[model samples]
Target chain A: MARLSPEVTALDTMPNSAATPGPTTLGEPTIDWDLSIRPVRELNQFLHDLAHNARPEMPHVRILHPNGRHNLAVGLQVPANIEILGHAGYFIAGMNQAAHITVDGNVGWSVAENMMSGIVRVKGCASECAGASAHGGLLVIEGDASSRCGISLKGGQIVVGGSVGHLSAFMAQAGTMVVCGDAGAALGDSLYEAVIYVRGSIHSLGADAREEPMQTDDLKTVADLLQRAAISADPQTFRRVASARQLYHWHAEAQY
Target chain B: MCGIVGLLVKKPELRRELGAWVSPMLDCMGSRGPDSAGLAVFAEAPSTDLLRYSLYDILAQDVWPTVLERWNANVDAAATLAAHGQQATLFSTTPSALGKDWLSNYFPHLHCFSVGHVIDLYKDIGHPRELIKKYRFAELAGTHAVGHTRMATESAVSPAHAHPFTSGEDFCLVHNGSLSNPHSIRRKLERRGIRFETDNDTEAACRFLEWRMSEGDSLEAAIHRGFAELDGFYTLLIGTATELVLVRDAFACKPAVAAETDDYVAISSEFQSLAHLPGIQQARVFEPAPEQIYRWHV
Candidate 1:
């Protein structure tokens, strides 16, 4: 239970507790956009326009009253530090190139789908497919993730502080995933080159996925992800799960 | 895809604002289901013997007054009607069985959406943004409500196909996904002399669960039996006289989020619909787990 409630290290860089508009004690100017007053289209349009002309410094943009709107801060190619003050909707930061996004509350499906690079952190639980088909970047969930947390991973690192639901990381082709807590059924299925480390119980393994002996490199990898994710789990307690390479080749004798 | 929303107030004073709070939620879900919409509201019973029947007619929106006057003069004199467009609520001391027969015999074209002492159902074939205004959903007041917007994946788009399907007294259900085994379940229930209204899959699930409850099983027990009986993806929300219930299928592929606070409990297919909730920033928001039963009593 203690491991599941790991501290979110993203708070260190976030604005003060107020996180309101205007300059904070950090001296960084904040731009406020309230969804209750303005429409989501205006916010996305402004963010999209800014993506073309890259700003020099870290423009601290604050969005309030998200009310679960979809596609907020998507296709971001800038280095702007954006903070969402409440719960958000699906695809909050899809196709994110190079931006630092911090969600203060829970999020809907696909927080950072197909991200090429950058960091997105969630302070609360996430729904299904948290980081599906991401080619690059890092996603950190400080709480439990629902089913298919990282399904069909294409080269992204996902660190889940708590449990992940069934069929997580299905048909993964690359990258790594670290679960500090329990994993639901079918941890990984038909994996290719993607690696998984679970510190707690695994309900079951999917087809072609098997537990392998943890090596020195595995320990180093888990240690690095845990350190970066701000989770307090020991590297030595995790078990490695990877593909068995049994389903890579088709055999005529195999029964359907 | 479809959309589902349920709200239950914990305080008595909050009951008056139930419609005001839930109207925006239904409008937010208009994007998910643009073809049709439906809502079921649960309020306090006027009396133990009083039954409220929601009647609908498509031929004319103003037919409710004539139907009400005719029923008052011919069927039950003590019965009163609160008509709203084509949708009308008949309040009477007559039992539901006799009430159904009376409506069927006299007004053959009028459809009975629901019959209960606390539930009032309104459904139509249009986007939620349009239907909410047409049905005057913002003026209603209740302790709890469950609403649905349908996309009509495999069925015809009609008011009857809309959700919040009720089978028994003071009970209604709405679903967010499809069922693969609805025909089989319908066949099984047909053998037990259960009649159906439409070919939609959600109605099959609604009737099955309500039938299980009629056989002396609690809603929780009926849902457990539903685990083995119901197949395919679903996020079901049910509203009763005194409680609101929610559940998802084994896969839980269909999305549903719940926001809970000291004042109320709200459930929706996505967090966006619940963004307007009170104390939303401090609400204990979380995704409901698959095959789990979450219930809140009024």
Candidate 2:
């Protein structure tokens, strides 16, 4: 594995390093292994056992499984780049922190659950309940994502290029959920400080989350999300959804 | 992953001439199918031929010989071909074929076929370009073709597991996505006397199409049936004698893009594969509508 040089780190920290072209300093520092195949159960067990006894030095993990494999690369806190070659089963690269993970193929449900930090990118589509209860870090789904993304999101950002399933951002706390495509029903149900910005129409908003007027702060957040997700779209075209105080702490009086 | 390219020339003499243009298109998608590469080229069927069958029947390996024997004895294929004015040829070209002996021994039906090269399907991944160059895949000619690069998950990765898999017949299919309902569909198709060699969702798709055709459904109608019945995320590209069809699953949980040109149309899992095709004055590129089917005739 190639080590990230101190000079590259210095350049990344500098404010005016944009003049240099090509190869941004911030991708996976190293990637180990080439194309190879392993059974689903065997690969899952290997990743599980490795996560338990993983050392700091093992910073790169490459997996080659085309068929969906459930529970691959769960509960790892090391700083590594785990790349899954093809479409994977549920909980792929789940509960990840410090290390970055990339799936060259599509992913199944609950990707990056309870993740504290680091990045989880899916080059293809994602199943429902993606990024459920995630605390911090960035979850980028290049393709469309199913429902319940960032549900109960305590922190971090989730940027999806394509349409999302129903109940997205349900019961979210502090954080942001950006959808470049249309969002499904019950978007941002009973939200707190978390902000939901969608470029397209919402099927239906949840209990307290109403259509809030787009503000300058909301625009800035949406712009940042679009820039990060690599989707070249105008930020002014989006709408914001925030919790309405009317439905907060629902009691007998508010019962309709 | 391996790459496959074929062109349907309006005229017979133009068939062999299409090799130059078709090679690059196939070479471009080589990244999708890297294990083994092949082109199943077909000349125009004789105008008078009424019945032609491309069979991809998977049974227990032990029952294969008996099934073939029964099929050959029960079916009067030569008389049918003569009545239709169509000449049929079959080739089993793969890395495993040591010599022409394998062809003569197993398939006595085929008279002669030109087999200059066959690329090693195993021990190869992430080397699509090198493999294409080695096999001189650019020189092969055909009217319509399908190609696949195996990323083996449910099935073994071997020459036998390669894509553009026919039912040993004319129908070919290339698929991108998983089938959540494989077990149910496989069992149903099996009971209907359909054979399955690979456990991949793609094989099921082929069998389903064949079964529909057998039940007297048109190619387009069979595809529509597949869209409604099949489950899971899929982007299916199917090629038959007269048309090329692209179908996306209801959810479209995977990626598939199509680019239509004045002279030809290309579809792939990604855009880079079809970017360089000729006469693409206005690239009509878009994602296939969810649960919608698109068909192009040759």
The top-ranked prediction according to lDDT is: 1
Evaluated on chain B only, what are the TM-scores of all the candidate structures, in order? 0.97, 0.68
Which pairs of residues collide in model 1? none
lDDT of 2 by residue, B1-298 (tens): 2233334444445456445555555565565555544444444554443333322222213333443344345433232211111112222223222323443455444322222121111112334455456545456554544545555566666444556555424567767677778778889999977767557666787788878987999877888888777877677777676667777776555656555655556665554455455543255544465567787776
Classify candidate 1 by CAPRI docking class: medium
Tell me how candidate 1 scores on lDDT. 0.86
Point out where model 1 deviates above 4 Å: A1-29, A252-256
lDDT of 1 by residue, B196-222 (tens): 989999999999999999999999999
lDDT of 2 by residue, A1-256 (tens): 2322322121222223322222324443332222233355554454455556546464455564334456667776666667776666578777877768888766767888888888889888787678888898889998888767788888978999888877788889888888889998788877887888888989889878888889898898889878876778788998888888666566887642
Each candidate structure's count of clashing pairs: 0, 17
| Candidate 2, position B161, lDDT | 57
Candidate 1 chain B weakest ten by summed lDDT: B59-68
